[model samples]
Every structure is written in structure tokens, then in C-alpha cells.
Target: MKHIWPIAVMALALAACEAPPSQEDAPFEPQYLGIETRLLEGDLVNFHVEMRGARKTRDIEDYARCAAAQYALIRGYGFAQHVRTQVEQREGLWMADAAYLISDALPKGVTNIDAEVTVAACRETNIPTV
Candidate 1:
């Protein structure tokens, strides 16, 4: 019947217009380039991290955080307070410049991170540290 043919065509058109599957299902393959550490002041330190295949800016930020945690531990510090993190992406390469205050006692901030705990987490998550 004419009505059945029209319905079938409309269904076919609708199916063709359906959106493609989401890219979130793709495997995350991130390559961490390296990290540069600088002593900004007495307790303040800066970390510059670079990576590729980052899913978002948070990935680069996390990389910097991991570096800061490990760096603090290396310096015999027990805690680090996050100051700021700047992230940029260029041509599939992501970079973050992060600052943290390394301290023996817990810093007075909401962003304070336990170096030992953070380093352990980073290792468990397969993220490299400085």
C-alpha cells in the first residue's frame, strides 16, 4: 500500500540520520613525555608536564599533580598544597604548568595533598611520577 511504502522510506531516512557512536568508547592511549621541576621559592615548586593523547585538560593537570606529589616525596616532604595549574593543548599535545607548596606538615588549604597517598594512587593508576 502507498502508506506502508512512505512509512518504510521515512524509517530508512531516520535510521540514516542517526548519530554515530560516541568516541568515548575508544581506548585511552596517553603518552607522557616528561616533567620539568623548578624550585620557585623555599617551599613553593613548579612542575611543567607534557603529554600526548590526553582525553581532556584534566589529564594533563593530573600528570602535573602526580609529578608534584613525587617531587615532594623526593624532597622528604609529606604534603603539598596545590597553588595553580595552567593547561594548554596544541596539535594533540597537552601541557600543564602547575605550582604546589611542599611542606612537612599539612598545608593550610583545601587543595592540600598527601604526597605518599597521591604517589601511591598515581602508581596504581599507571600514571608516571617525577
Candidate 2:
């Protein structure tokens, strides 16, 4: 019984050291690279979003879209219309350069995003928005 107690203690110590992966070490999710914004005109802004480990252009584009939506909210707009998005991969990281127009009314045919809702969605999906 004495020998068994020492073995159990060592086992418990090792188990404590082998902690599970934290949120920072999410293997299956794309990590945020960066976000940049430039005001082009009144209610129009250029957004750039880059993400590492994004397997597809859609992933990086979504990040950009999320950024744009959140930015519109920050700028006191209610809706964001996607003007254009250019996606590229460099050095194994995906980057999306996008343009958005913020407006009070939703545009026709374009994928319009509600500023508040999109920001919340980004947070829930682990996408960074600014």
C-alpha cells in the first residue's frame, strides 16, 4: 500500500501538468492576424483583415466582413453593405482587403449586415472584429 500511494501521487502530478488545450490553442479555428481600417468617404470605409491558418478565402473574407460590420456600428451606422472583397494568400496567411458602405437603410441585393448582430456573431464564432 505504501508503494501504491507514491505511484498514485506521481500519476496525479503528471496528469495535472498535461492540461488540455486552451482557447489560444484552438486547432480547428482560424486565428486573427490583424485588422486595419481607413476612411475613404463619408460612410464609406476600407477594411483589411488578415488571418493565419485560414484554409479558404471564404474564411478570411468572413473576417473582413465581420470587421466591416463592427466598424459600421462603431461609426454609428445601422447597416453595412459589402462593396467588394479581394482575398489573397501570402506566406501561408490569408488576407482580405474589403470595402464597405455604411448606411441607415439596407441596400438591395447585396449581403447587408446588421452592425450589432454581426458583431455579436463574430464574438460567438471566435472571429475578431474591430
Model 2 backbone overlap count:
0
RMSD of each: 1.8, 7.8
Candidate 2 Cα outliers beyond 4 Å, as residue runs: 1-27
lDDT of 1 by residue, 30-120 (tens): 9999999999999999999999988878888889999999999999999999999999889988989999999999878799999999999
Local distance difference test values of all predictions, in order: 0.92, 0.85
User: In candidate 1, which residue ranges exceed 4 Å CA deviation?
Assistant: 21-23
Poorest lDDT segment (10 consecutive residues) of candidate 1: 19-28
lDDT, candidate 2, 1-130, per-residue tens: 7699999999999999997976346666667979999999888899888788876677888899889988888877889998899998888788888999898878786578888898898899888889
Worst 10 residues of 2 by lDDT: 22-31
TM-score of 2: 0.75
Residue pairs with backbone overlap in model 1:
none
Candidate 2 overall lDDT versus native: 0.85
